[model samples]
Target: MATTEAVKAKTLLGECAAEFAGTFILILFGCGVVAQVVAGGIGDHDSIAWAWGLGVTMGIYVAGRMTGAHLNPAVTIALAAFRGFSWRKVLPYSLAQFLGAFLAALVVRWNYTEALNKFDPGLTRKSQIVFSTLPGNGSTELGVHLWGGFRDQIIGTAILMLLILAITDLRNTAPAANLAPFIVGLVVVGIGMAWGTNAGYAINPARDFGPRLASFLTGYGGAFKDQWGDLYFWVPIVAPILGALLGALLYDLLVGRFLPISDEDEEPGRIPEENTSA
Candidate 1:
């Protein structure tokens, strides 16, 4: 009875709170690592990737029991479209995630204010990279424009959603002993390593937009535009949403639909039945 009551206590508001907390943890570590690299010069690209991956793992562990830790808005939207998640809760969950990320970015900026000021002096558009992503990774040499950034975001987010569905599908070889989050974190690491340079691999819309908005509210008024005077903030937001839906659709068509149902099978991220009362 107590177990059932506890489960029932996870209302929509509670679930949204979990999402907020989980996303906060994710951005706290993810953006912190980036700030260290860009402002403090204490880490490199590999460190950024690893920290972000581990941050995601920790975030899932924090909120999985209550809400499955759909910390990314793209993940929440994808699950709603592909899985049995309630479509009605999508906007609320997304708003929670965005607020979480926004607060987390503010915290990062607060902690790194001295370092950021020292590094950039004037809080220029270059300094905004510490908070949000920049096209071509702020590289003039790459010449990566709007379409390139858009395409990169789509591909990266597609890979994210596809692997997420594959990893969580019970009919597939889902990890045992609650190891799915770790593996998913590793998937993020792989994506970052392979595709981060083009547009910072912001496969999640809230991840980019939240911090970008925070930067805008702060001194970096040019957060919505790139160094080249391009209004580029929409690329990450729109592309990831499209990519997640596309990836989920592909997964269902190619793999999920073909998997056979079994008595022992469970929903994508649910624990086994026997363990529910544990």
Candidate 2:
């Protein structure tokens, strides 16, 4: 007979584990590409965008069945607020995602220590870009301030959340043949290409903050603050959460509420099998 503790572990605990693993894979590949671009002198911005998209796809596949792969805190929060996802699970899911991201960033930093040293011996703010986002991409002349960065994150994340809901809603024209994860990945790619310049499009709070915290702990003195001596850590975190809420609200108000109802439609907050991975 299985122990109650064991059964419990296989339920919510297992879901949390899946979330952690999925996010670990996500940041592993996502930050790995950034490390390659910044430290290895290989690949361009487009390559980074593609790799990050692929990472998200793989992460979804990894945890979709177990926990719907809410690899982002913003995603988790949005789903809870709008999609009827269990509010109780939100904090656990977000914590798992953040821990996964943080560990993955630490691994990336460990793996690329040599390259980082060679690229930026002093571990300057330029080097920190590998681990976290920077305003105007650290360009002093670009004049991208905190407010602009916050706005960019909000717009980008709102778009992301809106599309996520659209793509997963069974009543909507979602992709067929279990390809929702791929399509969702492509959405990230599009966002990266279209809106990545300002603050690196850190539309996902965990995606930005986890590695950022890792960078701060790992001796990136400017990780918490930009070169301009301004504390910049809160922009990515707060903006994305608000953006996700806004996006979910917009979707519900403009699209979801208007969708034709049918018995075949999944319950609110319960994603179907095809898009469960997204």
Candidate 3:
């Protein structure tokens, strides 16, 4: 039994490593594109959108088999809630993911320091969009509203989680031949095109918080305190987690009941029953 416990620990370490690498790849491309496009003014929204979509796609392809490639903390928690993923690994998985995104953001800052300095004279909120998301319509409405940003984030993340479940639901028209990740990437693209502008469509907590923390440490200075000065940083983190959970539970209740037990690896990231409280 001691030997078995040791092996399990080793397996978990490997899983954490896989999550870290996948999230590193995710931030590398996703933040890289945004930095280049926004700070350098060399690309457009289309480029930014495609870059993140491809980032997620490649990340999944790299780590899907090993750790289920949950590069987002929201994804990790949602899996634990509904899919019987081990709750014991949640903190480890989130830490690995946050580290990956944080490290990748540092690389992105290094690569674009010159451009950033040139474009952003004060390195203030004007330059933060490259690293952290802020609401575009934070003060706009039929008149002037403040909570629109939160609503936008919730909606965008909900859409993201909904598509993630739909595309991977094996009992549904789930893609085969290892194409699920590719399809998932397209769903990301669709979300960006549809609602990305609202609050930068930060559907992943690690994807935003890690980079935001990195930005604060590097130059942004009090990154959570607000690029605009209102300290709305909590919106992205809380909203995405809530949205992912809601999306997953909604899908499971409405659609999962009709579907048969999945034998495929892409069964919404569920762990074996023996491994879970189920």
Candidate 4:
């Protein structure tokens, strides 16, 4: 019995490792595609968007069984907040996720160092490493961008949370599980195509901060120090958290309460059972 229990523990550890690796690969490829599109000059908007979408779809399908493919911290947080994911596990899961993303960003930097240097040698080290906001003009212009970014992220995350809840509900189990990846990928694609220009569509705080930190470490330039001040830095982090929470709350209000199933359907005696053959 002790041996059997040890084996199970090892298996769980292996699963966690796989989850970390899968998420790292997902971010590397997905965000790598973005870097390539913007810096490599190889593809148009449609192509770049499709690359991100397909990357996400494939990654989720591969990692879903292991770690629930929560490549985004916002998604994980939202799930824990609204769904029943154990609160104890949320911090570890999020930490691993953020680390995976950071590693992925480092890999992206290594892979494209030459290209990045060639395209914009003057680009700050931080800018070269990952994504973040640089001061465009002054407080007024920055405010507009921040507001727009905040609004778009709120709307997009809200919709995504709703979709997640609907698809994951046990009553609609099969379809929900089967198509969740595809639906999520498509939502990402739409967001990238629509709101990417404004805010880079950083719907996930980990996605932004992981790469940003990696950029800071690489020393490509001083983009982080010079451009990404505290005010700008915190907006992406705080806004998304608020947005995701709001979205989940809105979804719960709409579907969980206002449209809850009639008492008759949920009554203990009314549920239909499957027929069996003799």
Among these predicted structures, which one has the highest TM-score? 2
The residue-by-residue lDDT of candidate 1 on 196-265, one tens digit each, is: 9889998988899999998788788788988688999999999999998889888989998999988766
lDDT of 1 at 137: 86
lDDT of 4 at 143: 53
Per-residue CA lDDT of model 4 for 158-263, tens digit only, reads: 6666666655544433253388788778877887687665555667777667777777677644533323343455555666777777877886777655554543
Kindly give the stretch of ten consecutive residues in candidate 1 with the minimal lDDT sum: 269-278
Candidate 3 lDDT, 1-278, residue by residue in tens: 89878767877787888899999999999999988987878889999889999999999998888776788888889888887777888898999999999999999999999999899867777788888887773323333222666787777877777778888776888787999888888888888888876788888888999999998888787567553467777888898898888888888878887787756644566544433222
| TM-score to true structure, per model | 0.92, 0.93, 0.92, 0.78
- Tens digits of per-residue lDDT, candidate 2, 193-242, equal 99987788888888889999998898887788876778999999999999
lDDT of 1: 0.86
Point out the higher-scoring one by TM-score: 2 or 4: 2
lDDT of 3: 0.81
- Best model number under lDDT: 2
**Regions of candidate 2 where Cα sits further than 4 Å from its true position:** 1-9, 267-278
lDDT of each: 0.86, 0.87, 0.81, 0.62
Q: Give the TM-score (vs. native) of candidate 4.
A: 0.78
RMSD versus native structure for model 2: 3.1
